[model samples]
Target: MKKFLVPLCLFLASMAYSQDDLLNSLDSTQVDGKTPVTAFKALQIVTLQSTKMAAKKEFYFVVSHRFGTVKDGFDSFFGLDNATTKLGGIYGVTDWLSVSLSRHTLNKMYETGLKYRLARQDDHFPVDIVGYSVADINSFLEKDQYPGLEFKHRLTYVQQLLISRKFTEKLSFELVPSFIHKNLYNPDIERDNQFSFGGGGRYKITKRLSVNLEYMHNFDKPDFYKNPLSVGLDIETGGHVFQLIFTNSQAMNESGYVTNAAGDWGKGDFFFGFNLYRVF
Candidate 1:
């Protein structure tokens, strides 16, 4: 009986030690705390950038299309016959930093930009802050398009501060204060610098679907241009986010859409558009 009791005692002591070690390992992991809230689900809330970012080392491919104005009616297949498209790619350098390059069929514009997250929403923070800077070059612009146009005249720069709040699991909103600089324009008629403000929001209707709305108001809009207002539906599928949109803007890039929009929503000049985003 003494021999059996001694072996059992040793086995029980080993088991107790193993359990203590497991508890200590779990405690160490718990010290890292809970993960924070993810800001936006998609990279874009319509044409406006959202607070979402790609994970480190991840890549995203986006395709966007905008049809002509609805004012054309059936004559243009509700504007589908005059579609302008954009192709873009984005890469994450770090969880907080990303860069993208895109080409818009409208104006044959090419754009490159960087976005950085200054702050993220968490239990301690109420909002997500992001900075955006982009340069757009109108490669399609020619001397005939604008008399005496030089190569430098094709360049436009934009800067924006994006602030977003996730009020609840199903609601999110954002505001943008943006500045635009044009390298060359008709100085007699237009200013080289302009200011615009944008607002957007999203509401979830289902686990995989949501409604989105965005509008941009230019402070000193050109008489020929119109403010842009867009409404859309976001559908989330496996590794893809598809958006069906309608907007009073035909231009897709920040500079073009904000400053050169020609469609007037009051006149039923809105266009139908869609965007497809894929992650890899």
Candidate 2:
């Protein structure tokens, strides 16, 4: 009987130790905060990681076509020949900052420009500000001449201040105070070095579609010509953006539009323009 009793007690003690060991292992796992493995959890983690990487970079491209009547009175015999094409690219440097470059070809006229965002909207600032500079070169000007025709070669210089305010997720407005300098214009043609206080807005019609309207008025010389206004629509899909527009100004670049615009909508001159973009 004594032997049996001792064996029983030993068995019970061994079982108790085994149970304690199992509990201790579970407690250690909980304290280390290790999640249990599950198929769904694993997939959720992978999807989250992929989403984070995808948010890092974005790209876009666009091309546009413009046609209108030339206001220089050459259209009577020249057949109202005003047409242009524009190509553009935009890169997302960060979620809030972006840079863009665009090139325009208008018959013999070629122009290019760059835009940069210096500040963005935040809790403290309600408006976003941007700086832009554009230059127009008359390829038609003779380049071989010594000293060259500085006035003719350097067509226009435009510096602009852009202020944009977003009123809602789908609506926003912008104002531009622009200064323009032209070196080639005939001195006899009463002109002003400063031109165009512009304003425009964007209305989002859909998730990937929006319409924009912009206008510029030259306060320095309102009598020089008529104010230039542009209305356009943009379609954004993936890495591509398509812009369709109409305007009284046929010049593609800022310089040409500010200094060389020869169209007057009041006189029945208008143009149709479109842009197509793709990014890799």
Clashing pairs in 1: none
List the candidate 2 regions with Cα displacement exceeding 4 Å: 1-61, 70-82, 88-103, 143-148, 190-192, 221-224
Candidate 1 lDDT tens digits, 1-280: 3764485466435433432222113212221364456546678898888887776798887778888888988899888779898999999999889999999988899999999999877767788899999999989877776898887888999999999998887899999999999998777666899999987999989876899999989987768888888899987654356789988888889888788878888888898988866566
Candidate 2 global lDDT: 0.53
63, model 2: CA deviation in Å? 2.0
Q: What is candidate 2's TM-score against the reference?
A: 0.64
**TM-score of every candidate:** 0.85, 0.64
lDDT by residue (tens digit), candidate 2, 1-280: 3764485466434433432222113112331244211111000010010000011255555455566553445644222355556666656566434455566666355555445656555455566666666666665556574345665545667787777666776676777788888766555664538667766777778865677777777765545566677677765444233466667777666655654455667775666666543443
